[model samples]
Target: MATFQIEGGHQLKGEIRPQGAKNEALQILCAVLMTDEKVYIDNIPNIRDVNKLIEILSNLGVKIQKLGQGSFSFKSDALYLDYLESEKFKEEGSSLRGSIMIVGALLGRFGKGYIPRPGGDKIGRRRLDTHFGGFIKLGAKFRYNKEERFYGVEAPNGLKGVDMLLEEASVTGTANILMAAVLAKGKTSIYNAACEPYIQQLCKMLNSMGAKIKGIGSNLLHIEGVEKLSGCKHTVLPDMIEIGSWIGLAAMTKSELTIKDVSWKDLGIIPETFRKLGITVEKVGDDIHIPEHKSGYEVTSFIDGSIMNISDAPWPGFTPDLLSIILVVATQARGSVLIHQKMFESRLFFVDKLIDMGAKIILCDPHRATVIGHDFESQLKATTMSSPDIRAGISLLIAALSAKGVSTIHNIEQIDRGYEDIDGRLRAIGAKITRFD
Candidate 1:
């Protein structure tokens, strides 16, 4: 278990470039299996989860080559189908939540797919019903092995497109179904689909590779079945979650940091969400400049003078992933704010750690938290803690950076699963963080 020993109470000042979108990278990496031609991808982040997926693809006989830094070429002309049934594959596939995506591509191209119960952040109940349900709708026979916790889908005669309405606008679910639909026999119409930027990127990338997909940035997606897909070059967007994290880190630690090439147009409601917490978010040539909040930030009240409430919704609304950072930033703000995490039940449980550090916080329940800011009149006392999930881990690291003394965070592998070389990146920005392996 790796740990991070952070010497707190220091201001960071420098420019940091956000890495490629992790969520998008997962979908894009899986899409390579849909084509036999060479598909070149750029701006892929070297994080643990993404690397694990790439390793799985390589083990499945996909010819992968590193063209350059954060770039790769993949050719899936042949695949080891038998490997999908192997114990080694079950162990590898179950360990990564993103591995479920590969099943869609494999099913679309090879007529069959199998995956173990996938694992990821222990934030809440992340069900795979949406993924499997979408597959069944596309003419695939679904079976589950409760003893082994395994899922299998097979369409021996190839998939046929169908019009279906998704129960939830799940990003991964939509991507999986969309990938399968592109190769189906008829037109597929998806209603109430997730319209996140990552989904749009996947749609556009698929279109570029001979797929007839319409409604790039909307809820309804129409896909015209194509006989074959050809490979094409694609570049991933910068991670909006990481950009949001940097914004929170700047406000909490009173640092003046500039986040470079943030794709400001794609960052809907993120900068504005931070602004609601009284942080200055300036647009400097496609970059986000977060000024130091030496005088402390204030939470903006509602028009009716009610208590400020920050909640997560689907895209075009605030993202749930950043709500943890928002909760941490609200600790030193001028007023109180209620953080309602509608998507997950266990994310708010990490507030107890912040309360231990002298912050005024009320764990309203498993889904909500009420934070009463100390207004910088009281600084959080450093303490040793353990990371719970990727978002919570980064949120705790932000708290540690702003606390009074040295703080130790155990199980930093949770943090590394998402962020790429986070300690090295923070160090470049004048942060006093040391890592112990």
Candidate 2:
């Protein structure tokens, strides 16, 4: 296990660039399996989960090459299909939730896919029904090996597209089904699909690879089956979640930081959502400039003078991933705000760590929290803690950075799973953090 030792109450300066989107990279990396031609990808994040998925692909005989920093080339012409049934694959595949996506691409190009029960952050019940259900709707037979806790989907005659309405706009589910539908026999229409930027990027990448897809930024998607797909080069967008984290970090520590090349147009509701807590999110070209909150920030009340409430919704709404960061930032604001995490049940449980650090927070339930800011009247006293998940881990790191003393965080591998070289990046910007392996 790795740990982070951070000295708090220090103002960090200088600019930092957000890494490539982790969620998008997971989906896009799986999509590479849909073609036998060489596919080039740029801006890949050097993270744990993404690297695990890449290793899984390489084990399946995909010819992978490192072109440069954050760039790679992949060719899946000679895949080792038998490897999918191996015990080594089961161990590797089960370790990453993103590995579920490879099943769709495999089923599309090879007619069958099998996987061990995937694992990821234990935030809540993350069901795999959406992914398998979508596959079943598209003419694949589903089977489960309860003894082994494994899942398999197969279509001997290949998948045939059909019109279906998704139960929820699950992002990974939508990506998986969309990848399968691209090589299906007929037109597939998916309604109530996730329209997040990650999904949009995947759709565009598939289109470039000769797959017919429409509805780039909407809930409904239409994909026409093609004989086969060709290779295409793609670049991932900067991670919006990381950008939002930096915004919260700048405010809580009263630091003036410039987040470079943030892709403002794609950051729907993120900037405005931070502004609701009275944090200044300025637009300077493609960058986000967050000035020092020297006097502290105040939470804006509702028009009816009711208490402020912030919640997560589907695309174009506030992202649930950043709600943890928002809750941490609200701890030092001038007023109170309610954070409702509608998507996950257990994300709010990490508030206890903040409570231990002297922040005033009411854990109303598993899904909601009410934060009462300290307004800088009292500083958080740092202490030892353990990271729970990727989002919560980053949230705790932010709280530690703004605290009054040294803090030790265990299980930092959870943090490394998403953020690329986080401690090094923070150190570049004057953050007092050290990593011990």
Q: Which residue pairs overlap in candidate 2's backbone?
A: none
Estimate the TM-score of every prediction: 0.99, 0.99
* Cα lDDT tens digits for candidate 1, 1-437: 99999999999999999999999999999999999999999999999999999999999999999999899999999989899999999999999999999889988888899999999988889988888899999999999999999999999999999999999989999999999999999999999899999999999999999999998899999999999999999999999999999999999999999999999999999999999999999999999998878799999999999999999998888999999999999999999999999998998888889999999999988998899999999999999999999999999999999999999999999999999999999999999999999
Cα lDDT tens digits, model 2, 183-276, are 9999999999999999999999999999999988999999999989999999999999999999999999999999999998899999999999
Cα TM-score of candidate 2: 0.99
Off by over 4 Å in 1: none
Highest lDDT: which candidate? 2
Q: Model 1 clash tally?
A: 0
Q: Which stretch of 10 consecutive residues in model 2 shows the poorest summed lDDT?
A: 121-130
- Candidate 2 — which residues are off by over 4 angstroms? none
